[model samples]
Structure formats: structure tokens, C-alpha cells
Target: MRPARALIDLDALRHNYRLARRLGGGKALAVIKADAYGHGAVRCAQALEGEADGFAVAFLEEALALREAGIAAPILLLEGVLAADELPLVAEHDLWMVVHAPWQVEALARATLPRPLDVWLKLDSGMHRVGIDAEAYATTWQRLRALPQVGGLVKMTHFSRADEPDHERTREQIDTFAAVTAGLPGETSLCNSPALLAWPQARGDWARAGLMLYGASPFAHGHAAGAQLQPVMTLESQVIAVRDLPAGEPVGYGGTFVAPRPTRVGVVAMGYADGYPQFAATGTPVAIDGRPGRLIGRVSMDMLTVDLTDHPDAGVGSRVELWGRQVAATEVVARSQTSAYRLLCGVKRVPLVSVGG
Candidate 1:
């Protein structure tokens, strides 16, 4: 064994979902897209199946996987049906779809399904990535409402700056959404993880909980509204080798880190291939046998070196925590100039162990 593994705490995942529901002030859709943000979709969904109001994924295949896994909870497709052909599966699986574009509206109008499908009409409040413009929203709503195959219709919008509490753009988007869907019927969903945590007023009939459900804060500044959500995944490995390098010796490819003094360096069995950031600068945090240490060199394909000068007892076979309760994924990404989401989703090849469901 490589001694490298990701320990997923399902209890922490459940707690985070509950926290989202508590703060959302309405039904909470646990967003499990991107394979539950790399925590293993089926496993996480199974753990949350009992308590989640619904499970949300980005595609129809993801929903199908959950269905195949025997997940009976309502599954919402965040990206909705990519093609008209998927509408059948949507109805068959009783999945909720986010009708963002005009094509989806037309598709729904054209399709003759065995049963009516639930849909969320996405409004392009601010984010230009998806959804229809405000002007097209009401008309699209009318079109979808007229469709015989459309069942429950929910008004939905995504936040462009929900993570930035101080930003005014989120407020603008919320106002735009309210104004556009003012007289329209059906439930509404506007809050993402950040909005659910920081902007209580953004909550509607349904809130989408994504990153926060995994216990990593979505905010760029602090924890999830300082909520006591536990981290779900702990990336762990062990020191495979140790060396005492004298001053003037360089370490790793490009010698990015030179020993300022005689230093004890410990080689960890995890690296970029295992989801560790490749450009993680020197001084990035790591935990050795539960004690703090700093990364000392560039992350290699299969190993990373950590400065263990302060830990005289740390050597080969010592436990190392890449990120977890001790070193948050947030902190690690901050130093790496990336994000916790990328780090989490980048995890592959490493074995995953689920715990505390």
C-alpha cells in the first residue's frame, strides 16, 4: 500500500447538510455535482439520502447513477437536460431540471413525456454563464408553464458574488430575480452555499448547498459564517524517507527551496498526482504526526518534501496530514494559489475510505 488515502467522514457531511438546511430557511438541495466535489458521489449521496430534501447534480448521467444506486430522494439536475432525448430519463427518474436556456424551454414544449417533469426556470440575474436574460425570463416562464409536460415550476438564479458578503452585486442579482419573477407562480431557489451561509434574505423555497456541505467554507475570507461545520475529507499519507541536508543544498525540481540552514526534510508519499497542488509554494502547511510543518519544495508527481527541522521526532513512517481538521483545505489552497474545490475534485488514484456515517 502507498499509505496515502482520503478519509471521508460522512458524519461531517451530514452535519454540514443539516447546517445548510438550518441556515437556508427552506428546503435545501444538497448539490453533489462533480462526483460530490470529488468526495465520491454515490457514497456521499447515500449518507445524506435520509435527511436531504433533495440531491442535486450537474448532469442527467449523475442523476441516473444515483437512481441506480437506489437513491430514492428527489434528484435535481442543476444543468438540466443537455438534449431533448434526456427528457424521457428526466421524467422516468422523476428528476427536477433547471431550464436555463430558451432551447430547453422549446425542448420541453416539443417533448411528449410519459409524465410531467418538474423544472426550475433559471434567470440570468447577473452571472452571464447560463440562464436566460431578465427580459426573456417571464416569456420563457409562460412558455414552460403552457407546456403539458411541465409540472412543478421553480424560479431559480445563481449568485455572481454571493461569496463576497461585502459585495453589492449579489444584492443586485437578488433584486433582479425578485422583480422578474414577482407575479410568477411556483417555488424559488437563489441561494448557493455562500448565500445560504451569509445572506439569510437570499433564501427562497429551495437553497442549493454545494461546497459548504463538504465542510469547506466558500467564503474567501472566513469560515462558513463561522458555522461549526466539520471537514468531511482528511487527506493523509506518511513520511516515506528522511534526510538531513546541510545549508546551501537545494531541494526538489528547479531547487525552488534552498535550505536556509541545516534542515531535516521528510518526504511524503502524496503529491500532485494524488491531488496535492503542484505549485504549492514553500511554507504551505502540512501536519506531521498531528504537529504543524511547512512544505519545503515543489510538489512532485508522487511525493512532496516538508521541512521537519522543528520536529526532531518526525522521520520515515511518521503520519502526515495533507489537509483535514488540523490543516484546512482552504489554507492549503490559499498558499497554493488555487482553491479547495479544485483540490478536492482533483483527488483521484488515491484510495478513499468512508467513515462516521
Candidate 2:
């Protein structure tokens, strides 16, 4: 078998969920959308089965998959029903929905279900993504509350700048959500991973832990002081070849990197085809035999070259970690001008091995 495989540490996943719960001080929904951000939703959900207060997904299909996996915990459809026809499936699966648009409100009002649906009313405080305007929030809330089909209601709004701790936008959003939903007869959820970590005040009735639940820091500035999260997925591969190139010799496509001195380059068995970032430039961090190394040239479809001069002992069969404990996904992506979320969710074609559930 190819030595390129992703090792998923389920223990770290559960630990992160527990940390999210501790920080939120309330019910926390493990955001398992995008196939649990490429960590495998079914496996991650099963790992957090009895631990997480609930699970949140981008759409109804994801919720259905979790339900099929026998996950009994509440599954929330973050985007809610896409069309009126999906209402029956929402009710049939007893899924919680996030009513973000007026059309969704209209659909719910027009349809009669076997059971009342629990809904989270979303307000577009500042994100301007997919939410009702603050001006329409109160009226929408009242209208949804009056609907016999609506069983429980929760006020929710997403933060656009919560990752930037110094930014005033998150604070403004929090205040706006408060002002719009004040005295409202329902629970509230405004914190995504970043808000829940940086702004304690943003934590409401339900905290949605997305990237953090996969054991990565949500802040661009790096891990918070007290919030130390263990990495859950370690992307590893073996060194398939090692070459000693003479000075002035070029490496990889485009000759992006030329040896300034006699350099030892180790070819790893994983690449963009396996979801490794293609634009990752020279000097991106990697680990050879658990020691530090730097990506030396352009990433190829099935291979990437790493500077193995410092680790002269590293050769064929040596372990190479693309990202995890030693080289963080956050660090690797930062060098590549991308986000950890993309790296995590973009992983495809690579086999996964789960450990320590």
C-alpha cells in the first residue's frame, strides 16, 4: 500500500469538543459539516456521539447521513431547508433548522408537519451573508413564534470578524444581535469557533464549534493563551526517494528552486492530488522523521520535494509529516496563503486511518 495516509486522532477530537463545551459554558454543537471538515463526519460524529450536546451540518443531507449512522444526538441543519419540499424530511428526521431567509419562513408557515419543528431564527447583524436584516428580525421572530408548526425558537447570527480579536465588527454585531433580540422569548447562539474562543461574552445558549472541534486554532494570530488544542489529523507519507543535487541544479517543475550548495532533497509520496496545497511555496514547513524540514520546490500532482539536508539521516522509507503535531496545519497554510479550514476540508483521495476513539 502507498505510505501516504491521514492518521485521525479521535481522542484529540473529543478533547477539543470538551474544551469547546468548557469555554462556551453551555450546550455546544459540534460543527461536522464538509464531512467533518475532511476528518470524516461519520467517524468524527461517532467519536463525539455521547459527548457533544449536538451536531451541526451545512444542509439536510448531512443531517440525514448522521441519522443513518445512528447518531441519536440532535442534528441541526445550519443552512436549514433549501426548499419547501424538504420540510417533510426535516420533520421526519426531527432535525433542527436555521431559518435565515424570508422564503424559509414562508415555507414553514405554509406547510403543516407531523410534528412542530425546532427552529433557529437567524438575523444578519453585519455578515450580510444569508440572514434576515436586523430591521426585519423582530417582525420575523414574532411571525415565526406565532406559527403553530414552529415548536422552539433560538436567535442566531454569524460573526464576520470574530477571528480578528482587535476588530470592532464582532463587538458591534454582538450589540446589534442583543438589541434586536432583547426580551425575546428564545435561546440565542452567536458564537462560531473564533467568537467562542476570543470573546467570552459572545457565548450564548448554543456555541457552534467548527474548525476548533477538529483541533485547530481559529485565530490567525495563532493559538490562544489558555486554549491549547491537540491536532486531530496528521497527514503523513513516506520518503520514496532521496537525491543529492549538485550546486546550480534545479528541482521540481519550473525550476522554482535551484541548489545553492550540494543539497539533499527527499521526495514525499503525497501531493496536491491528495489535497496538499499546490501553491505552497518554498520554505513551507514539513517534518522528516519527526525533525523539521522545508518544502523546497513546487508541489507536483503526486509528490513534493522537501529539504532534507539538515536531516541527512532521512532517506527512503523515512516518515514525513505534511502537517500535524510538529508542523501545524495552521502554519503550513499560512505559508501557502490559505486557511486551515480549506486544507482540512480539501483533503481527498488520501486514505484515512482512525486511532484512539
Candidate 3:
């Protein structure tokens, strides 16, 4: 059986971390959340352990998982606690929390803890997603800080349009973040990946890098050299079958892609089940037999077919790169009409061999 594989390049990951450090020019937290964007949290974190200032995850469970894995690095919980009960664990594990709501503030004020907690005050600069609005930020910060459980405070905000380098929204968010925490006595974190790469001004006291570490550009149309990144994960599969199709013969379920001419096709031993995207329509690119080809059918549950007419030498058992070094995830994301964040996080139920071959 063909084993669908994700070859994670630790060197690439480290290089990206270095890039973030150079560009951030300050403390940099690797956002190893989402299982390090489906690259495996424990492995990715362990690889970055010595070099990174800290690792940032979405919740306490993720932090605890890393801790249980012998990961001794400091962890920042970007989403903070969901329930009042999670507070003790947060304190016990020394996990930094991003207190964004009144309930959390109240809970922190109530929780009895042995050690003070570091807090990253999340201000709703513009996204208006999960953060406490700027107007109420100070009061909330003051309340959270008043708790004997609180240690140092840090201000943070997520960008709504940093991915679009030309969008004025990033500037607006920066201004709002600045205006809210102008003289506040705390460190500030503003940049995500795009900000860290493109908006030099967004690099504050710290930057939380997410997509960039996996070698995906946060800005649209940004290239590897332009963003100064390295490709971290390369997903590959093998062809299990090959056949010829007559002109106009429909391929795959629902006739998603009809052969334009007498075309050769190779069925790869990978599909949605192996983390290959399901909605990836025909014409999505793939590397077949070490050659570039196009996916020619609807992505199936167990496998997907690719056009091999362009590569006459392609055959069964040939290696196929769904997305990776040569066939960048950015390229896949563009063809799939999705983001690298989704693509990387979407990888599931597949054996990802980290440290590369």
C-alpha cells in the first residue's frame, strides 16, 4: 500500500524562525498552535525549543500536551481559558493567558493561585472578533492585574487585513493598537506573519508567527525570496493505477473534469482521507513521477486522479507531490482558492515524517 507522507523539513522551519527573529527585531513567539499547523506540535516545538523565545498555542490543552511531551519552553495561550476551572491549570503550568473578556477578568480576580500569572491583554483593535474593545481594555487590564495571581502584563491585537499588504486596515489597526496602549506599562505584540514580513512598523516588542513558520507567505503574491522563508512540509503520495481516457470521457465523480482529448491519467493513492483537499477541483496542480501535472478529477475519498498526458513517461507507483518544496503549498492554496493556514491545518490522518528524508 502506498503510504501518503508529509516530509517536514526541520531546517526550513528553523530558517523561518530565524527570519521571524530578524524581521521582528525583538522577542518572537512561534505560533505552534493547531499541532504546529498540522506538522505535529510536540515534534515542531521540540525542534524549535532552544531557538525560540517561546511557543504560543491556542489553549491550555495544547500547552499541557507540549508540557507532557517534555517540552520545557514557556507557552503562551493565545485563546486563554474557556472555563473558570481551566485557570488553575493555566497557573500550574505557567502558561501565559490572553485575557480578552470580562468573565475571564472576573475569574482571574477570583482564582486563588500559588504563583502569579503573566497576562497578555488582548485589545479589539479592529477585527472585533474575540478581543475586549479598546475603550474597555484599560479597565479590564487593571482588573486582571489587580489579582494577586497576575504577574507582568502584555498588550496584544490581531490584524484583520495584514494579509493584504495594500489594505489600509493594517495601518488602522496599528493606530488603534498604539492609541489604546500608548503609555501602558507593558510589552506589546502586534504582528502576525504578514505584519512581520511586510509591515516593519507592526513588529512591536514581540511577534506571534503562524503561517510563516510553515513556509507559507501571509501576503498575497509574496514569494519565498521576497518573504525570506523556507518550505517546511512537503506532502507526497504514489500513483496506484494508470489508464488512458478517450476524448470527452468524464473522469471522477459528478463528471467534475471531462477529458479534453485522449489523455493519460494516473490515480494517486491519496485523497481527502489523507489530508488532500476534497474541494480541490480539476486543474489543481500536482507533481507526478517527479513532473508537474494537473489534478483532473474530483478529489475522491481514498484517491484522486491526475492528468499524465503531458508526461508520457509517468507510470504506476510514481511519486506524486501534492504540496511541498517543489510544488509549494502557496501554489496549492492559490489553485484551491484557500489559504495556507487552512491547507496546513487541514492535513489529518496521515503519517508526517518530520526532520525530512
Candidate 4:
């Protein structure tokens, strides 16, 4: 069996969800899209179903998978139906959907369903992504309201820069959403992980918990709220081999790192194939035998090399933490030049074992 595995602390996941709700002062939908950002959707949903206000996924298939797995909580389809043909299934499965573009609203107006679908009308609101333009937001809401197939409607928008905390752009986006949807009589969902953590004023009737639910801070810097998140997944492995190299010898592909002195390098059985970032630089952080260490070479597909010279007793079979507990995923993500969401979602080829649900 492979030595690498992801340890998912379901207790931490539940803790983060509760934190999001408390921070936003409203109901929170645990955003479990992309297989709970690759933490295994079925298992994650099972772990969270008991107390999650509901779960949110990117599309219909993900929602359907959860339903099949017996997740009876309200599930919102963040991207809505990809094609109009999916509307029937969306209706049949009792899925709520984000009706963003004109075609989705048009499809809703035309469809005759077994039941009215709960729809979230998404406003463009500075994200300039898949949403109805702000100028047309109210009219679109009215249009969806008139549809017999539409049941409850919620107003929603995504933040483009809430992670910055001090950025005026987030304020502008929030104002835009507020002004345009003024007088609209429906619940609002504006805060994602970052906004929920940083911008209290922007939190709406509902919050969407995504990256933070996995226990990684959404902000590049620290915050009181971000400090509350507990890491959920710990990617761990064992040292498979070690090399004693003299000063100036190059290491790994491209010889990106040259030994500055006599170096003891420990090889780890984890890499890009296991969802470790391939471009994570030589100085990236890792924890070997519960002590801090630094990666020392270009990451390989199935292995990476870490400097172990500081730990005289560490060698083959020493425990290595890629990210979790002793080594924060945020630190590794910052050093890798990637976001925590991407880092968490990129994990693959490693078995996931759960504890503390």
C-alpha cells in the first residue's frame, strides 16, 4: 500500500461550518463542490449532513450524487443546470439552483416541472462572472417570480476581493448588490468564505462556506476570524530514502537546489501525482518527525526531497507531514504560490481516512 494518505478530521469540518454560521450571523450552506474540494464528497457530505444548513455544489451531477447517497438536506446548485435538459432532473431531485444567466431564467419560465424549483438569482455585482447584470437584477427577479416553476427565490452574489479585508473594491461590490436589490423580498447570500470571515457588513441572510470549511484560511494574511479555523485534512507520508551529499552537489530535476554544505536529504513518497504542487520551491515547508524541515529540490510526480540535515536522528521511515497539524496548509500554499482552495482540491491518488466525525 502507498505510504501517503490524507487524514480528514470531520470534527474540524463541523467546527468550521459552525464558525461560518456564527460569523455571518445567518444560515450557512456548506459548499462541498468538487468532491468537497477533493476531500471525498460522499464521505464529507455524510460527515456534515447532520447539522449543515444544507450543502452547495457546483452543478447538477454533484447534487445528484449527494441525493443518491441520502443527503436529504437542501442542496443548492451553484452553477445551475448546464443545459436546459437538466432542468427536469434538477426539479425531480428537489435541488435549489442559482439562476444567473438569461438562458437559465428563460429555461425556468418554460419548464413544467413536478414541483417548483428553489432558485437563487445571481447578480453580476463586480465579479463580472456568470450573473445577470446589476442594472437588470430586479427585473430578472420579477421575471423569475412570475414563473410557475420557480418556488422560493434568493438573491446572491460572489465577492471578488473579500480576502483582502481592507480593499475598497469589496465595499463597492457589496454596495452595488445592496442598492440594486433594495426592496427585493428574499433571502440574500453574498458572503463566501472570505467575506464571511472578514466583512460582517456584507454577510447576507445566508453564507456560503467553501475553503474555510476545509480549515484553511481564505485570507493571505491573518485575521481574528481566520484564526478560528482548524485544519481538516492532514496530508502525511513517510521518508522512503535518504542521501548524504557533499557540498555543491545539485539535487532533483533541473538541479534547482545545490547542497550548500554536507546535506542529508530525505526522499518522501508524495508528489504532484498525490496532489502536491509540482512547482513548490526548494524552501517550501514540511515537518519531519515532528520537527520543521525544508524541501530541497524540484517536486517530482511521485516523490519529493526534503533537507534533513538538522535532524540527525531522522532518516527512512520518519514521519513527514506535507500539510496539517504541525505544518499549516496555508504556509505550504503561500510558499507554493497557490491558493488553499487549489491546494486542497488538487489532492488525489491518496487514500482518505477519517476521524473525529
Cα lDDT over the full model 3 = 0.87
**Backbone steric clashes in candidate 2, count:** 0
Instruction: Tell me how far the alpha carbon of residue 102 in candidate 3 is from the true structure, in angstroms, after superposition.
Output: 1.3
The sequence of per-residue lDDT tens digits that candidate 2 reaches over residues 119-197 is 9999999999999998899999999999999999999999999889999999999999999998887788998989878
**Candidate 4, overall lDDT?**
0.92
* lDDT scores of the candidates, listed in order: 0.91, 0.92, 0.87, 0.92
- Of candidates 2 and 1, the better by lDDT: 2
Residue 297 of model 3: what lDDT? 80
Among the numbered candidates, top lDDT falls to: 4
Kindly list the per-residue Cα lDDT of model 3 for residues 1-357, writing each as its tens digit.
466888899989999998898889999999999999999999999899988999999999999999999988889999999999998898888889998888888888888887999999999999989999888988787787677889989999999888787889999999998898877787899989888888898878988988999888866685443457888998998888999999999998999788889999898888888777888878887888677788888898989999888888788878999988678787777777677888899888778897742
TM-score of every candidate relative to the true structure? 0.98, 0.98, 0.96, 0.98
lDDT of 1 at 318: 95
lDDT for 221 (candidate 1): 76
Candidate 3 local lDDT, residue 330: 74
lDDT of 4 by residue, 161-234 (tens): 99999999999999999899999998999999999988989978999999999999988888898989999999
How displaced is residue 340 in candidate 4, in Å? 1.2
Clashing pairs in 4: none
Off by over 4 Å in 4: none
Each prediction's RMSD over C-alphas, in Å, is 1.0, 1.0, 1.6, 1.0
